[model samples]
Target: IPQFEDVKFEAASLLSELYCQENSVDTAKPLLRKAIQISQQTPYWHCRLLFQLAQLHTLEKDLVSACDLLGVGAEYARVVGSEYTRALFLLSKGMLLLMERKLQEVHPLLTLCGQIVENWQGNPIQKESLRVFFLVLQVTHYLDAGQVKSVKPCLKQLQQCIQTISTLHDDEILPSNPADLFHWLPKEHMCVLVYLVTVMHSMQAGYLEKAQKYTDKALMQLEKLKMLDCSPILSSFQVILLEHIIMCRLVTGHKATALQEISQVCQLCQQSPRLFSNHAAQLHTLLGLYCISVNCMDNAEAQFTTALRLTTHQELWAFIVTNLASVYIREGNRHQELYSLLERINPDHNFPVSSHCLRAAAFYIRGLFSFFQGRYNEAKRFLRETLKMSNAEDLNRLTACSLVLLGHIFYVLGNHRESNNMVVPAMQLASKIPDMSVQLWSSALLRDLNKACGNAMDAHEAAQMHQNFSQQLLQDHIEACSLPEHNLITWTDGPPPVQFQAQNGPTTSLASLL
Candidate 1:
């Protein structure tokens, strides 16, 4: 409907962006198609629209279409002489390749992206944003590929880029729906900033506290600019904050406080379910972990199943699979599905410091499965691998779990001296972390070690330690699980039946969505 070619080209680009923002691929496709058609006549438009279409397909999970679009975008970028767009498109394509598990295919695209960004001459600030996105993408690639040394440089670059973006023009933000004449500013740039902050927090690469602080600063900046009403953008901040709060409480040994935070998260999702899909899935998975720690198998199962149902991200799905595998292993199911899933997901067999925590859990849980099945040699191998990986990491719970497994492996192999050494280290690490789950596991191992050695005094001391830790854990839980004084449920009977189910669709759990 635009009369001029320029107007028509701009209209198509804007329409495609709007559709992408709203998660409306069907609505965005025709606009992208028109843009592609127009670009054939005008080569300049071709580079931009082709890149946009590539990203669109990536978002829609249509990898083949995205690859085709990226090929065109790469070609058009060369024809149109735009280094910035070329770098951006290549990075997008590289990430898609990484997701497809095509590890070899990503390096060339990432190298090209780096080359283009290094020479780009757009406004220094805009060029810097593009560079930051690429740097973060590169970091992700390294992390996923287990190239631990390569990650630090990207993290350093990202820190510098964050500082630059903080000083960017105040006019960069705009109302989400009004779509004013904002030439130098793009709304999606802020969205990208939110994502970068999130990745920094999740990876714990460099300056996590600083990243959280920046999130607060960004939120304040958005508020001052009256952009707080942007639901999708606002949801991103809320999601990260909620997750951080829960993790902080759990890590600090305030299990009760952490459980209470889950209630608030549930409330957040109930208010705007679609807006918080990613967070909802993540919360459920965490809740399942909490349930498992407390020996609530039914609740844990419900939570894990729910998490798998709610989201399709490979990482999220992998977490659920690992947890459920532990559950089934404990319940004596021997199909080996969990082992297969972990092997598939962890093809590179990485144990980077950042992911060492997850790797520890995976290895320790599978080792426990082997131990229960009396495969002592297999258990010893898995547990020792997990222990070796736990060194130089800050994951208190995982380190504790690994040590406990190592102790059990030593005890099984009839090495009492080594068993004692492992048990003592495990208990010390478990004590450093505030999680009752690790405390219980460590104490149980200590008691077993004492009993095997026929040391009555050592056994008695361990029993006492176990009693104290158990009491501390239960007291924390009791305080945390208490409902508000005003909303407390007063029962005329002793306790409600376990079979009583809440209506309203079986009480959708955070685990169920994971």
Candidate 2:
């Protein structure tokens, strides 16, 4: 009877396979558990069963649970001296960490995995598979650090590994998402990551259309990935894609439509709590930003506060606190509370936000509050710091925004020459992004400053630019109202997950594959 355990496992595994074929997790899970129990005496198959269970959890966007299952499987492999299974579990764990944006933790584990896989005389396909994943993790790290040069070598190595494993044995597990049964899943995912990183870099460089192009490509690939089993990664990619879209829309003189898009997403999330709870913090934060764009201070404040309350992630908390402080400054209320939250800012605090955006946000909010409270000198200090950091990070949009704030500080302090100088570059940068609102305000200030100094020609030019921006903004509103409301995005989404956002997965980043 004890020897019959393998027979029992095969039967249960078959039933589970049937359930999986139908995408019926409720039926599949119990069967998998039974199979795992039956296969306990067979460590190799038991580990495989645990992995299948973890994959199910991953598909459901329950990455934490997936990690737990993999952990147990790893320990079981080690106990049984199953080197290949241990290495496989480690690779899966590393991928999960990479998806979680825990970059610091990923490298060490992946390095060890590479060593173990290399030394062990295991299945060649599995070794190549681990090698490919390891390279991807490295590539991701380099991209996040904005070192495109460093990524190329790793990418080359990954491609070579893929090319080497041209044929798969019937016993081998296929490497993550294969496109059209020819291209490996890792290859597709690498392309997705490459496009996404390039999009973010392009945005920082103030190349809006280039960023949009890359975003469209990345979104297309992400949609294709949804056809596979893992929705968690795909869902995270969709979030990042939407963030890029909103930013592009806001800057390219489509603020009204951008606001409408975020509003629709927020409303959809609210109606479908499962589709939103995990991403509530980001969704609410985006809504707050839209409200701020429309000068809806009360609504923005509420949305930001809700976002803050929803997230327990330390970095996201910092990001939300900064936004909330901005809202408080805008309302000219609760200065002390704003300062209290701002006090947590260390500039050295581990920020998971893209390219020092969190630090820029902190300084900008601090400067704004100081400006509102009439502490001109303090405001100037913080605003300058904000600009320095933004420029250092090559975050062109934030730098432009900071320059506008700095110009305002100068104008109020009777430093007309400096104010005028600041506004000129700020307007240039704003025009590049086509952020009409910033351009409008900066040009208006320049016009007034020029007129007050009795410079008629310069005043007229500034006045014309301001009027032009106002008209452009009005035109945008009209176009937005005239266009039909249905989403024109052409990509196909996979079958909607029954439990969409579980709120319990690993915290990646605010605007990441979170």
Best by TM-score: 1
In TM-score terms, candidate 1 sits at 0.71
Q: What is the C-alpha lDDT profile of model 1 across 184-251, one tens digit per residue? A: 22434454454444544443422234444555665555455446355454555555565665565564
- Candidate 1: regions farther than 4 A off: 1-3, 11-28, 39-48, 51-56, 145-150, 164-234, 240-252, 256-283, 309-312, 332-360, 392-397, 408-416, 427-436, 443-468, 483-514
The alpha-carbon root-mean-square deviation between model 1 and the true structure, to one decimal in Å, is 7.9
Model 1, CA-based lDDT: 0.63
Per-residue error at 260 for model 1, in Å? Answer: 4.7
- Per-residue lDDT of model 2, residues 1-514, tens digit only: 7657667666777788788778798999988987887677776468667877998888787888898898888787777776666777877888888667777777788888878878877456656666666666676565455443445567567657656655645345543321101212454565575566567556655668878888888888787787884745556566666776776786777766775565445444444445576676776676666556556677777777777777776556776777777777777767687667777764546444543566776778778777888898888888888787777656677778888888888898889989888888999988887667789889999999999889999999999988988898888766644333212111112221222221465432233464
